[model samples]
Target: MSSIKNILYFQAGLGVLANMFLLLFYIFIILGHRTKPTDLISCQLTFVHIIMVLTGGDILFTDLFELLNIENDFRCKTIFYISRVMRGLSICTTCLLSVFQAVTISPSTSLLAKFKQKLKKYKVYVFLCIWSFNLSFSTNRIFYVGGFTNVSETNHMRVTKSCSLLPMNYIIRGLIFTISTSRDVFLVGVMLTTSAYMVITMFRYQRQCKYLYSISHLREPPEKRATQTILLLVSFFVIMYWLDFIISFTSDMLWMYDPVILTFQKFMMYAYPTITPLVQITSDNRIIIMLKNLKANHHQGLF
Candidate 1:
């Protein structure tokens, strides 16, 4: 149990640090003159991941609230609500990233090309809608989550050491579940569709390359590399999301949280957010260049 707690702490800490760096890098790029449309989407994704990690029922919020001696109802509700909102935002942002990248890499003659110019202009409105939807979608959580008060209570579903999901009316629960599941399914479907489209686009691009250049001489183009990165991210996220969903579903059905199972679930829940920023940072050439410049500047300053 201690070991699992340690792992959770490590996951949250590492995720927070990596995401913070990625967020700063994106901010720098967006503020610069050479920003791409995809950069804004990626930046929002990084920011969402950071909040997900912090509000995650891991080391940060739990420990801070414990130290500050906050009230149980407020602490649990605030943490759980914010975490859910971030989780929703994470998926929404990822799906948007996949779709935007697909549209971005589409050839001028492709159908997606028609929306390319309008995407940049409407990106802010899209983000606003995503945020508003998630914020309201997760409001039910605030009413149903609170500090675990009774060990014998069969009605509560334990989510964290300090927080548990309290029972609500069956109709209400069913309604919330339906709405939540629908949202997740829709976003995931979009992500998979866009990913498949991107894969097809890449294959065609590669075929074109094969016609023009020797196989041995072929190197991935910048667009191809970026598409590959987003594909990898989408694939990883889907796996993690489904795993977390299964665990949540099972626990809710059983009305009990096994220590081992809960620990694994938490790990799965944190895995994507923790891994996302690292993947983005390593794949992005701009971030790589920035890191190298920072290192060179540090050495020069030392002299």
Candidate 2:
């Protein structure tokens, strides 16, 4: 257990570091070249990563400070409430990224193209709405999450591993379950649909160009290339998301009873958050351009 906990903490620290670096990179880009609507979404996404990785189970760093016992209802409520808020925010942000990219890549002749033209100017408003909805949606958790302080015969207050939760009345419990399921289903569906649309658009563009230019090789534009990279990252997120869901769904029936599976599940859940920054930086055209220029300058100096 000590070994597992140690590893978790270590990975969490690394994830936090990665998120910080990505956040800085996003800031650099936001202030520099990539000021499009898509970049705005990217910046928002980066902020989500920084906040969630710092505070969420993705780092497990916060676990060290989780000393709430049965008597600390306020502590329990606030901690879990914050966690839920951040997690939900991350989900919304990622879905927004997918939608933004899809809109950005739509052809000028397409119906959605008008919105794409205006999206850049109004992206801040969209971001504000996203933040508002997620924060409001998550406020209910404050009432649902509770911790207990066990006062023993020795008059010692001890913290238990599991805190008490709200009474699962049919209406409240059903709504929570339905809401969580709907959120996941809706977000993932949008991401997948948009990503597929992007892929198809690329195929069609290449096909048309091939016939028009009699060219065997079709080069992807930087926009398409970057969007594809983002799609790949979204694919990675999707995979990890489902794995975590499956493990969580079966945890009590299977995984939770086994330390190995539980540890693996925890790692799986955190893997995307930990690796996401690296993926983003590598996928970012601005970062890639800067690296290429640096290498060229180094080579020229040598000559």
Candidate 3:
């Protein structure tokens, strides 16, 4: 348990740094292209990542205090509520990125092209509506979550306290869980389908180039590199989030007393945000060049 707690502490510190770096990266990108739709989505994603890390850090700190036998109901409720909403928003933004990129690379004669034109016109309104809906759903956490001690555990020789759901009738609890999970399921589907569409479009473009010798001279890749980058980022987020949900679900069902399980749950809380920036930057040639230039300058400074 001690080892796991130390590792979590390390991760929490890294999460803070990771959020800061990604915030800078996205802001820089936006400055370079002040009006691109994809740039706006990237900024939104980075902002959410920062918020996610901060909220997760709150949970880590609260859990630490609980380990020392301190439990605060207000802190627990506030942190959990904010974390869930931020997490949902993060998923929404990633889905938007995938959909937006797919449209950006769609053929002009396709339905996606028409949708893309509408997206440019109404993206601000769409994003705001998403934000409102996420916050509305999170209101349930205020009623459902609270800090509570595990009175069943007499192993007070050394134990930790954690936030738990406020007990409700089985029907209500199940309903809330179902609704929340369904939203996640829908968003995950959007990301996967759009990503696959982008991949197919790329392949089709390649095949077309092969058949038209005259047009082959003017052939371009079906999708932009940035489109693939955003898709990859969404794929990574989906995988990590699905794994986190599975682990959390299993832990809840087993209702085990192990601290390791709890620590791992907390670790998953930070994993996506902490690693997303690294995945995104590596996928972008511009960011890679900037990083290399910075490294060279740093080496020169050492002299």
Best by lDDT: 1
For each of the candidates, the C-alpha root-mean-square deviation to the true structure, in angstroms, is: 1.6, 4.6, 4.1
Itemize residue pairs with steric clashes in candidate 1: none
lDDT of 1: 0.87
Per-residue C-alpha lDDT of model 3 across residues 30-144, encoded as one tens digit per residue: 6777445687787788788777876774546575655776547776777777788889999999999899999998899888988987998899998899899999999986886
Candidate 1 vs. true structure, TM-score: 0.95
State every prediction's TM-score relative to the real structure: 0.95, 0.81, 0.83
Candidate whose TM-score is highest:
1
Hey, what RMSD does candidate 1 come out at? 1.6
Q: What tens digits encode model 1's per-residue C-alpha lDDT throughout 68-183?
A: 99997798898899999999999999999999999999999999999998988899999999999999989978988888767465667777887888888889888888999998
Of 2 and 3, the candidate ranking higher by lDDT: 3
lDDT of 2 by residue, 1-303 (tens): 788778777776777787777677767877877565666676666677666655554234335455333235655566566666777777778888888888888899987788875777777787888788888988876675555544332322221233345444668766876788798889999999988998988788888788777565556577877787779878998898888777656642231224476568667656777787777777777778888999999999999
Candidate order, TM-score descending: 1, 3, 2
Off by over 4 Å in 2: 58-73, 148-167, 214-218, 251-262, 292-303
Considering lDDT, where higher is better, how would the candidates rank from best to worst? Answer: 1, 3, 2
lDDT of candidates 1 onward, in order: 0.87, 0.70, 0.75
- For TM-score, candidate 1 versus 2, the one ahead is 1
Model 2 Cα shift for residue 288 (angstroms): 2.7
